[model samples]
Target: MSLRCALQLGIPDVINSHGKPMTLSELVAALPVHPTKTHHLYRLMRLLVHLGFFAMQKVADNHFQEGYLLTPASLLLLQDNPSISRPFVDLVLDPILIETNNCMSTWFQNDDPNPFVTVFGEPIWEHASHEASVNHLINRTKASDSSLIGRAVLVKCKGVFQGLNSLVDVAGGTGNMAKAIVDAFPDLKCTVLDLPHVVADLQGSKNLNFLGGDMFKAVPPADAILLKWTLHDWPDEECAKILKNCKEAITRNGKQQGGKVIIIDMVMGNQTWDSDDDKITEAQLLFDMEMMVCGIGKERNEKEWAKLFFDAGFSNYKINPVLGPRALIEVYP
Candidate 1:
């Protein structure tokens, strides 16, 4: 909550603007909080500093003796940062998610397939289908996440897109990933396939276009199909169907010599960071639960993923673990 409070207060950007460690008095004066509540700000900052969002430095001066500075984590949360994670926090902490979570215990006691269904008598998607405000927040959060991941993927995994002329971003929200790809490879044609509501009226560029369709029915033909953070929302049978359609799209299209399907999603047991912190592992587990609660899927281990690919009739595949909390998987026909 303190992290959320700091973000709500724009404390990181304020500290950044100061260009130096800011004393409590200076920080309070720079904030919009009530003058009578400056001590509350100090307490909040104390917790934030302890949580590593900000660093406290001991400084010697006549007027002030110590100050706070932004940490790397807080730097990424700054509103003006291109890779800001602010929207992610908002979505994760939104009342919709929290309310859904509150139903988990009752859902486990009942016959409901998922917590969301237990709470709202419908799938999360169906709920979003009617709530434009919630849908918009979902889009903002997804676009924000894609903006950060797209830039990193282009730099660290350019080879994934090498030699590809036509690509499709399956269930791609707002076409951020496809746009990034087309911007880097102007010759490559990129299409984003999603529900009608997702792609409706969305503009496209010279090498990029939008297609509204259900992946369970069909996917647009392309040399390569990209599914970033998409498959986790479904179970094995549905994922298999999507992969099968992807195969038919990439191979029958006659775009390349056995085209590939590139997937970016979490593989449950693949995390092996040397860093001893348990937070990442915990977050992954939480995400697995999120999939379970919001829809009909959970994170898979390597063997589970392999089984899904083989079940879809893919001859070969590769996993690249460069992305945080998720990996890039290339499935070949």
Candidate 2:
């Protein structure tokens, strides 16, 4: 709740733009708040400090001498940060998404597909389609996440797209991932495939195009297909069907033409070296639970992921441990 409060108040951005530690009086002046509510700001800051969002220190011998600074977690919440995660924080905390948590128990009692449906009377994707606000929230959150992933993919997994002449990003939200690839490899033609509504007003570049379609039905022919944080939203059987379609897409174009499918997702147990940091492991487990409650997906280990690849008729694969909890998986036909 404190985290939510801080986000609502834009505390991270306030301190970040200030360019220095912010004293309580300075923060209070910056906020569009009532003068009588100054004390409330200090109480809120105290709670956020205890929650590890901010660090407070006394700089002078006075009642309001305390100053607050952003912690590592809070830095990510800054709106101006290139890899800011504020949008994701906002989306998860939005009323529509939060209401789903309240209906979790009710969903378990009935035959509804998910708690989101019980609360909003529709699935997540459907709700996004009809509700403009929800759709914007989802897209903005995805765009922020993609910016972070883009840095990792370019720095660590550049080899994944090395020799590909053309590539397609399936379910690529807002084309952030595709934009990164295109900027890195100017010679490669990149395409983003998603629903029509998602790509309706989106513009493409000289070498990049947006094609709206369903992944289960068909995918555009490309030397390589990129699935970044996409497949995990579905169950194994459904993932298999999607992978099968990808395999067919690659084979139809000519399997001998050095075609491959690159996947970016979390692989549990892949971070054994970081076991000393219990917080990292705890976060991964928490995400697993979040997936269980919000979607049919769950993070998988190497073995589980390999099984899915083989089930989809892939002959060979390689897992390059690059991103922290996630990895760059190369699936070959």
Candidate 3:
């Protein structure tokens, strides 16, 4: 709730744009609230500081007065940051999702598929389909996240797309990932495959095309198929089916130079470095719990991921732990 309050109040953006550690008076002045509420603002800042959203430093003489500064987590909330996670933070903490937590108790008593249905009177996707506002929020959140991931992938994981002539981003939300790839490799033809509604209003570029279709039925033929955080939204069997389609899509490229599927998703227990071990693993587990509550999915460890690949008829696979908890998996037939 405090985090939500902070975001609503634009505290992170305020402190970030301040260009220096923001004093309490400066923050209060910048806030839209009444001047009489300055003390209340300080209380809120104190709590947020304790929660690690902001850091407090002694400023005035004698270390009596203090100034507040944005932390790494708060920095991601800055409105101007290219990779701002504010939309994701807002979406996950939205009132619709928050209300579902109360239904968890009753949800376990009944035989409902998930708690989301119990609260929203429909499944997550069904509800999103009916609610235009929620659907827009979800799409925006996904696009923002993709932009952040795309920047990192283009810079650090360029090797994944080196020799590939054609690539398809299956279930690609708004073509942010495809745009990034196309920008980096203009010669590589890129296609974004998603639902009709998702691609309806989205624009395409010279090298990137948007295709409206279901992955369950077909994916466009390409030298490589990219599935970024898509498989985790499904059960193991469903994921296997999607992987099979990806395999078929790659095979369509030809038998002599059969292609591969590039997956960017969480692979639990694959964290090798200390940073990955602590931060990435913890975030993945948290996301797993979130998926369990909100959708019919869970984060998979490497062995589990590999099992799905093999079950989908892939002959060889390699996992590169480059994207935090997520890995760049290459599956070849």
> Global lDDT of each model?
0.87, 0.84, 0.86
**After superposition, candidate 1 runs with Cα above 4 Å error:** 59-64
Name the regions of candidate 3 deviating beyond 4 angstroms.
58-64, 255-258, 272-276
TM-score for candidate 1, please give it: 0.95
In the order shown, the candidates' Cα RMSDs to the true structure are 1.7, 2.4, 2.0
Q: List the residue pairs that clash in candidate 3.
A: none
Best-to-worst TM-score order: 1, 3, 2
Query: Would you estimate the TM-scores of all the predictions?
Result: 0.95, 0.92, 0.93
**What's the CA error at residue 250 for candidate 2, in Å?**
2.3
* Model 2 bad stretches (over 4 Å): 57-66, 255-257, 273-277
- In candidate 2 the C-alpha lDDT for residue 18 amounts to 79
Point out the higher-scoring one by TM-score: 2 or 3.
3
Better of 1 and 3 by TM-score: 1
Tens digit per residue, CA lDDT, model 2, 68-96:
88999888888778788888878777887
As for lDDT, the candidate ahead, 2 or 3, is: 3
